[model samples]
Target: MTPPKLRRLATAGLIAALLAGPMQAAAAQEPLVDHTPGQADIEGGATAQQDTNSLDASLSDAEKTADSVLTVDQMAANQRALASEIGPDGSSLGQGIERLATTGDPQVAPVDADAPTGTAAVSYWRPSGVYGVDVSSHQETVDWRAARNQGSQFAYVKATEATGYINPFFSPQYGGSEAAGMLRGAYHFAIPNVSTGAQQANYFINNGGGWVNDGKTLPPLLDVEYNPYPSLGNSCYNMSAAQMVSWIRDFSNTVVTRTGRLPMIYTTTDWWNTCTGYSTAFADHPLHIANYNNSGAGTLPAGWTGYELWQYTSIGPVVGDWNQWPSTLSALQAFARNNTAPAPSAGSAAITTLAGRTTKLGGATSGVVCGLIGGGCYQNYQRGSIHWTATTGAHATLGAIRTTWAGTGYEKGRLGYPTGPETCGLLGSGCYQNFQRGTIHWTTATGAHATLGAIRTAWAAHGYEKGRLGYPTGAETCGLVGGGCYQNFQRGTIHWTSTTGAHATLGGIRNTWAGTGYENGRLGYPTGPEICGITDGGCYQDYQRGAIHWTTATGAHATLGAIRRAWAGTGYETGSLGFPAGPETCTLVGGGCYQSFQRGAIHWTTATGAHATTGAIRRAWAGTGYENGRLGYPTGPQTCGLVDGGCYQNYQRGAIHWTTATGAHATLGAIRSTWAGTGYERGRLGYPTGPETCANNRCTQTFQGGTLTWTPTTGTRITYK
Candidate 1:
């Protein structure tokens, strides 16, 4: 199908899905702001402040009852309200379709000297194996050993273009490939308007030829994206697909004649149709395609067997690995060979680790250090069990240190054992006293070692936590791996405010808090110098303040707990909610709604649903009914506080119209709820001016536009205004 056709289908699907869900309602228990009932007073101190505020005369629970549920008639009204906001000229659909269908340009290149000499073997295409680089645009260095350990063998480095225009991102990737010791190749972006094929070839040959190793270099690739002709601003808009194909062909042929390497095409699917007509002009050559979703391949023009490489998705983090690309090294090598057949090499030796120490049975010994104090290293800086070692022989002892994860992550060492105490005798003072101080003594034949105060307390061990102090402290702390005292001095200690009930805290010089429940009904177990106390009190039970008034129950019918107004709460919200950094709007009590005013996203509370906007931008969109300065207001039969899709279901923006799936209608932004099962859920309003559906008890369920559909399960509700 054409791009336009596909977009139309997508748009329809999106619209259908939007209209079916029910609008949610406002929260019944809009938490009282800072109400401290019968707060106890300290002796001879100021009295505790009580919550005092006039009730909103125009706003009450009963006043909102009428606007809660949305009827089918209201749905139509919502559609009309949004009609003007969606599509060009208020049409039912936007721009008809996404794009038109067309032909892509044919590509030609010099026969690759590195191409396999044997006849190309036909093979079935299957999505198997990993394809990734040892280094990437983000990493400045690469570890060959680590790469090899992670199974990396193939690499792609960035190259240059002619006309003096270079890829803004280079240097690091170019050098990292060598550091990684992976088989390598390079590619140049087809810079439209500036560099012709010859220019690109000359630039690459001059700056990138060294990347090839005999026949090992992967085939050259051409990145062709946006059209580059400056004079064709809108010209390409009306140009036939055939024309686009011609331009690409001209560019392709120029580079091939100069480089003596087959140039593969790298482009998006839409660009393919506009320039290649999905024809066989370059059918024999490899094609690297970037289709974020796997669903679009079947729609490829006829005669296309399969892509040489496919970038199916982005942003995947595999365990024990690094790189933004989605595939692994072995898979990359296979993909380079087009998975026709396999060649063999013995796998690298296995690495053994104990107690957080590692050692390769046959790996070299030059990098090991022997004097490390701790047997295991942690990622954070805090003290742990320190173990010192000293070498005693010519063939020095070699071994690895293990971390909590049971891996040999780093190396350690120590000097040869003392030849004799007399050989190091002069190191001590001349005071020849030798007296025991407890179980140990600082003494020598020549003199007693410097007084106890002279010994420096350096960190000898580290643990899995971060930013721990030297020596044992009753406070919670952990150390980072590699024997650091603390991860960084900056993230020292994170303190929180007082909280009611049994709130636990971590303690100990090692900062181990994984265990559950406090000892003796206290916050955490005391260790060394560390101790736990109530949030409002100082460390240890001694400094705890007497009971505060907020703890007293106000009775069964009365509401309790913190409630954010205007904006929602997120990330340790203790005081009034603050403004966000993005777009926002505000609302008045009864009417008046506007859109598109720059404003800092804000979180505010109102006595009677007053209109206000304050945040990033100076100006604010105007509206009402708990406007968080977002798009619209919340509407549903159930109390808005109901949690759905990981966010509170009741939050909504105020008075802004956008195209709803049902047609043009007011756009009611959905609120994310922390209580929702994994992610965020959508909510809407009941009343509007057009053909749209408001959320309600009858229809609040996520709909598939009458057909089954998938929505993001993980959503965020921690929005401000």
Candidate 2:
């Protein structure tokens, strides 16, 4: 008996011839004889006289008279006849002979003609044209060359199962079959219960399920059948027929998407009908049926028009399962080429045509149809894609501009579908693509930019590239404080907060806004468009928290929060406190805030809201240490007409008084009461000469009419001259 490895070598030689080309027809004149035990004799050969009880004498008279030098058609018929006798189980005269021949165990007793074969049998119906076999580790190693020489025309080798589990014999069997000139394909045994169909398909393709359009390679095959669970009594596992069908479809679709070739289906008729409910969705894919009964090709699973390859018997001239393709070699080759070719779908025809016309796109690298988004299709290439839409037709997007568009959400994003092809030779040798919603611009200096919605409208109104704003430099960004969006331009920025709508800020106003921390500063976000016709023809833009006022007089100043409100209350620049003279300064004396205006200045502290002081009143308050001095932040605006026709403003600590008699002076505590009692400036003791002269633990201020003094020990005293 031949060793398993040696047998495999011999088989490899036989199968190699089938893959290389058509087999040479055997000469009709040669006489043939069966040399092994349990053998048959061919016509024109002398009969061997052996004991009837021995294996060699078991052949029927009809088998003994079979023709030895047979045509391809004749060989296919004989294989089918023998497979019918074996059936699905290893029973009958045919299976007995095959087991004795393959395993070389002559002592094993033969089963009755109608008994089960223990092993699953291939279909019995013989296909009249080409023939082949599928193999796995179960066959150990195959004599592929011998199998091909004996009339096998093609082979499908088991490659992977589930996510893991690779067939050890796959490499040798695949190479041996291919080398023997057989049309070869790889198959995956799907375990849908263990993992998803897509995952298994990916694993299968990555391992050995992939196929090219080379004439010798066949499309991949999927082997989905009875579940391998031992404890379960049913073959369908826990899934219903519909679920099984869905699993099979998912696997087939995934395989087609990755390899661009729909896989052939390998399943028995009963399993297909019962487990998959006779699903017809996969009718377009080729079928490889396994039905081991003698009924021939009378019935098939629903959906399939006819079978391509039929696995007819577990035992063949070689030591592996046998199959047959019911067509001539030329027809088989054409089928392979057609199935592996790029087949167009609904919207893909236009994209396919576009790709053919464009030289740079090369060929499509992916088979995913773009129908999921828009009513279009896209075929991706090395550089870009050939995008097709019913309305926009077909166009090509490539290079940096394409990259930029993809960054902005591709077709599903704000840009939507490409309306026009990429155009070059713009202002700076740039390129751009127009989309349904907006346009993407690209240049060496600016890279690629997207401008859309209101921001784009504003940019266009400003003359776009020719205007002061120049070209856009970035995509529009949202999620601003006031539901606003913004995009940067070459010369400046366009802001679109809710209150301000869409507006552009440039030059000094832009600079001043930046210095004040832009939107993040005390001014917050812009609330309204900038106004140009304020007091002195100044421009001011309102913000969420306050406003920034700009003019030739004040440059640009931001007045916000309490101080801004105080200024607004005074009629802004039109009333007393005119345009801001300077930006608001805070963290001042006594933790106060202040801003200077054309008329006067407004100061505020936590204790004192905000009050304005001007002219001599402001000077008087400043002299008294302002908020930090004896007279703190003003408690009220200045008022005229005291007892002596003087003006005074109250503060947190004291008050400042001004009159013609004594300019401005701060009168506080007991001195203020004493002065007021003496009729202040109206009576004889008029305004004080100076602040206060202190010595010998006494404080005194000499009035115009008399001298007033105070001490802790003496309380108060007045000296009149």
Candidate 3:
């Protein structure tokens, strides 16, 4: 009888041939293995199992004869007879044999390189040799204990690949290897083209590459090889040999820096030589050489005098890449121990003490240290930094305070160095950090803020910390309108224009300025800060357009644009029109604009420039519907020092005059012509005491000097004094 393995192989071959039919004839001639370079390198080489059934006593007479010369029809008949052997209950005796025949063997065949072939009978661990296996997700479920029992001393389980992929099988394999008393390590499959080498290395170390100084754990390995991504084009990842070398160096250095241990470099001889130009710069690091030809590692790659591990074959009893370590296990353990020794603590006593104080904040003496001002040191922490000096004990700077300090360049910045730790529970529920140059304050309402330079100097003069402005709410920001900068404080804001210098704006005056779009609107930037102690405990601020004036009686008002220029011509706030009582009201009567002041108001229209009307003169103009009335817009400003101690303002069609005795009245048309004829106010008619009264085609005005009348019958009649 044929052996069970050989019999199953024969039956499976027959079934495959019957399924293929005419295609089997063509397929039988082709080689079982494709010896393509990159393609064949993956999962070792291909070795086909031969199907031989020379000895078999169970064959029937007809089947025996047919096996020698089987046609498609005969094969079909045999398949039908075999199918009936599968009963409803389960696989029959014949069907069970067929199931075993189709399943085949699970062992992957080894590459047919010119190496000494070994079976399970051969001892994997020689007295002089150490052995391990490198595995990734492709290995699936592994009996790690069985592998350990087969003389495997160690295992390097793949942890991460590229930048984002993590091996799903890593946890089980790593834990099983360690549980089985085999030394275990983790490795990353390097994909330099996918991301920066440093970033990938950090991801690797953070995931599983980190190693404690345990003698049972091996140093991490970086699996750099031919590009597995052929679809991306180029076996060398489309990079030049020099670039590949730099990428490898960057990855190795980053791994070493992050985890206090140097990583072993794994590569095939040809891959290293071709992709990296056989660079020998990494001579000091350990090498893991892979060579399938198996002529004793087949000429080790450049830079590696001797390799720590050699992947001799892809097919092994452990179901992974088989590796052989030339050194003994103790030497390997020592190598792992030496590379992962803890780093030394910081040298400065102050920094060391600071580290102890800030342990919960992730501060450590082993962190990066830099010189601080006046003979001191500063150490960095995950959340913040600690500055130490003889004068000031080490203090942590974090949160908003740290951000403000960083904006000014930390210790080396304009703030120089921190003088004290942040102090809380200040006025307004705020916190502040003092620096050599200035201070940064923070509150829940305003976040962290900084103030310095000329702006800070001006704020300091106004009592600063104790002033109404209180703590700063924001940093000094520049590039404002008219090439200026401003800083916001709790109660007010300080602005500085090149021409105006530094000044503060507060209360109502500031609000009015803001209503005009601050410095960016028609008013432009503030020419000067708010100046108080004016006409009536009022305040005023000058701007490029005009000025904003505030008083308890008039509130705050902006006087700008055309009406403002007109107001300035009238001696501004110091004149008859004291401080602006109201903002300029535009689109008024007949498209006119007007602004109210302490004395009176200035009104302007397209038809008339701008003119002021005060007291009774303003009242008389209002009675005529102001600019919209028949008198039209004001032609000129109100004029006083008339014939008596009176005032009059000219209009398009009429004029309004005022006196102590005659109040104020408007005189126009024929009544005004008749009054002029009577020598106006200088003549018999002093100033019109009352406006022209008309009835039944007759009009008359009662003046101080005379009464002027007009009629259709009598052209003009004057009752002079």
Whole-model lDDT, model 2: 0.66
Residue 594, model 3: lDDT of 85
Q: Write the per-residue lDDT of candidate 3 for residues 1-721, one digit (tens) a residue.
A: 1212212223444433333455445543432122212312211112212224311222234333322223334334433533343122211001111122233211112243212332212433232478888776766688876786677878888888665667777788887776444678998877555455677788888878877665566888888764433222133443444455666667777877877778888876555654555566677788887654335766776667898887765556765467888877666656667534423334256666666766555834223233334655555465776776666566678887887777666665677667777888976688988887888888888888877877888888777757867778788889986789999987888988878788777888788878989878777777776788876687888887777888898898988777888788878778878878778888787788888888888888878888888777888788888777878888998888986687888899988888898898888887888777767788756777778888999888787777777899998888877
Candidate 1, residue 354: the lDDT equals 22
Query: How well does candidate 1 match the true structure, expressed as C-alpha RMSD?
Result: 39.1
Question: Taking the tens digit of each residue's C-alpha lDDT, what string does model 2 give over 1-721?
Answer: 1111101112333322221223334434321121111111111112323333332233333322221233344333323433343222221112222333344332233454223232334543354777877776656578875886677767888888666577777888887776445678898876554455677788899988898775567899888764332121123433334446656767877888998888998876545654454556677888887654334444676677798877666655565466767767667867777644434465577777778788887765434244336666666676677777788888888887777776775776788889888888877687778999999888888888988887788788887777878778887888876677888988888888766678776667777788877777777666655678876888987776777888897788887888887887888878777888987788787688888888799999888888898888788777766777766789887778776677888888677777777677677777777887888777788766566667988888777788888999877777865
Q: Estimate each model's TM-score.
A: 0.29, 0.51, 0.55
**Most TM-score-accurate candidate:** 3
Candidate 1 local lDDT, residue 718: 27
Rank list by TM-score: 3, 2, 1
| Alpha-carbon deviation at 430 in model 2, angstroms | 5.5
Give the local distance difference test score of model 1.
0.30
Per-candidate clashes come to: 104, 26, 2
Error of 2 at 465 (Å): 3.6
